[model samples]
Target: MLENPVLADLATDLPQAVRLQRLAAHLRARFRCGAVALLQLEADHLRPVAVDGLVPEALGRRFAVSQHPRLAAILARGEVTCFHHDSQLPDPYDGLLDTLVGEPLPVHDCMGTRLEVDGKPWGVLTLDALQTGTFGEDARAALAGYRVLAEAAVRISRLEREVQALRTTPPLRAGDDERGAVGGDADQEIVGQSAPLLRLLHELDVVAASDLPVLLLGETGVGKELFARRLHRQSPRRSKPLVHVNCAALPESLAESELFGHVRGAFSGAVTDRPGRFEAADGGTLFLDEVGELPLPVQAKLLRTLQNGEIQRLGADRPRRVHVRVIAATNRNLREQVTAGAFRADLYHRLSVYPVPIPPLRERGNDVLLIAGRFLELNRARLGLRSLRLSSAAQEALRRYAWPGNIRELEHVISRAALKALSRSGVNRADIVTLEPALLDLESNTAVPPAAAGATPARPPAPPPPAGETGTAPGPLRDVVDACQRAHISAALGRCQGNWAQAARMLEVDASNLHKLARRLGLK
Candidate 1:
């Protein structure tokens, strides 16, 4: 048997979450700490994925790194860092310890270390104690050793799961493969095996079993609706109706009626009684897409429905009870909307009882290629092409280009490029269609630096005035550079359809920096 019980336990074939929880429990027992928790880094927040001694509510709470100095500092470091015994920083685990009853008692000492896997920071492993100096130097050293084992366990578990997925996944028929919908269920299946994607899948699996309101948060085109559908399919209400309501598309005048039904003569167009989406989705799920666009009056009504499971239809005094499990989605930050008096605070909290954030395409690494291949196959089938593939250079370009529009943009890009390639091949009398980098139409400056994938070299800066000849006589070199910058930024903004944030991402600069550059270049 292995000397370390934690490591030995992790080596067993337990589920990933179970193994993680066991690790946390073991660490807590070994160190005699008040609590031990494993938090996963999701975007800008540290979400407790597994906990040993923390209160059950802590598992649902997400702590923003910026708001938590200790977490921010710990994430910044590669090794463990312990807070002072008398540190005054507010604990994220305040009132979250199982031992705590009413109000939060101050924690005496806290230590945290960033959990890294394959050189990437995965998350943080935190240990908190009620007594001072509980986590001494010896304990910190032991924790560091445990961290390595934790990472190994995670990697092993992930690899095993991926292997299992591959083994169990049925092979697609030639026709289905050509259709580009892997598994023959494009609408239902979520592709990619990246760590982030897998984590999301696991979160979905956990939340799917519950009837809690789910709020899907992510940038546009990250497929929040797809996740919502998956959640509904996995839930007990799969057999019931899954009603979709586009809050953004609903007019202010009809918003109330659209959500909560209308009796005859309730409004100018209400010729007959109409059951709203909530009633239509009774005992099932109501997916509210772009929920942030809901007007304040409608929001209040929605909140009432969420709170009391009752909805008063238009021109009706009595309320009808709805057994709908709501799954709301919005690219907009609802918390910010709540602060701005746009979204109701209570409604926001209610909808976000279980928030699931979808990862954007750019952040998903090589999964981009996998998704691109699916799109390529789709385009090939649509165009009736025998073969359509990306050239090595085209593949590099696709990987390098920041997918501002996420998966949706990727599909369009692949489709457009395939069409262009098909046209070119027809003109050239070629049997096979291969898309080149130029066909991708990615902005040169906005694309990732060529050194990234080693497929191309960066173009040397304009040969600099041809020795002494002052090229073009456009004032100084500074002016020429500024002009070039202005043109490049303008082109990027155009490519991103005037989304400044997307433009900034394409240009590989901070959004504020891009704004400053645009202003300085007179291109704002």
Candidate 2:
């Protein structure tokens, strides 16, 4: 009747994101279901704009309609689409329901209804339950009846955005087809809404309007390349090619020729004339990744190109004008490099006109959960598991640990953890898997979230040298040492059930030190 608390918030001036989130939560509560997801159709994919009873990373997922038959069937129908238990179509969220812990159980019921706003197809609202008959005739009628209210909620949220966009940004031209919470390549979207990330996005938006050379400074694996892509896509030259070059990957001998084309026979392998990255990116942007790795000789030429908007091919007679915008990025401290004389001072100054320091994963607060959710989905799909989620303890371990490797490290950790969790015999893809701190295998010490350092589990003392394994008189010293190191690490790993961090503690050494030693002993 639109009088309930669920629909009341639609009239409130809540932020569009908050409003959609609340709508999903209310829908879950109202339906008494396991999870509720509001997916916005972007191109051919269904992106979850808001979700309740889902692991945090679900927001980062983009479900292709072609892959999820249930979603596709729902999208095709104006009426409520119900997939009762035993329906042949696989549920898009097999093991993703937040309620399923330990092992995955088959989801019993799922139903969805299409949402339309302003006479146009909007998206869809889906509800899932772990119990059969949850979406019976009454439930189906209720969903269909509430469909209008759901559509209204979306309509209200959309209008709010349109109004704001009208005030701050230009109107979307006709046929731009820009509607809903979806746009851009789904893979390219940044996931979190943390204050620091929001602030950075705002700053990037401002900088993207100009043609200034931007230097992205951050630790490795912090997604510097992703940020550069976002900047280029946001800029005026979005339609033009955004050429990427890894200065560090370029061979020292070919570095100049790579960045500034080469004439025929410029070098031994240069059989024909070729355009460099800058020329390839003409009328657009050239992304120079690991810019600090550029050799000193190349730095001078790069400085000239940035200043004069011109590049000369190696062995060419003269330089020619080329309109290109430079967006350079590096993990190294350019200022320190300049001070140390490894990088040219003038080039450093020119490139850092607008330096953007990308914050590491640890700084983004609960964003870790959101990002982890994304990874969880990916792992779930990859491992063919019905559901994969982090146990509360595992999530705490993630939050506590310093992400030295940043997002790259996080991706590796999640992927590895999923595999380890699934390594158990008889674990089925239909079974839900919960990742505990043990499975995460994070450095027990480093993975401990900040302020929780004392929470690390203490190891049992070194077991009295294994009841007779005293420093023995073995053969060659190097041979003996290697054999002993390998055996000891192996025994520790076995006792700890293959947890390296746990084994490190049992050995009474730092986890990193243990890793290095293991590698040296061929025990890793």
Q: Model 1 segments beyond 4 Å from truth?
A: 1-184, 425-430, 444-524
Model 2: runs farther than 4 Å from truth? Answer: 1-8, 100-106, 117-120, 162-183, 444-524
lDDT of 1 by residue, 315-414 (tens): 9878999899999987666675576576799989999998888877778876777677556655654675544556556667877877655776677667
Q: Using Cα atoms with residue i matched to residue i, what is each candidate's TM-score against the true structure?
A: 0.53, 0.80
Number of clashes in every candidate structure?
Answer: 0, 11
TM-score of 2: 0.80
lDDT string for model 2 (141-248, tens) is 888878888888888888887787555443443444343112376666677878999899878867876899999977666788878887776666766778899775
For model 2, the run of ten residues with the poorest summed lDDT: 447-456
lDDT of 2 at 139: 87
Model 1, position 212, has a per-residue lDDT of: 93
Best candidate according to lDDT = 2
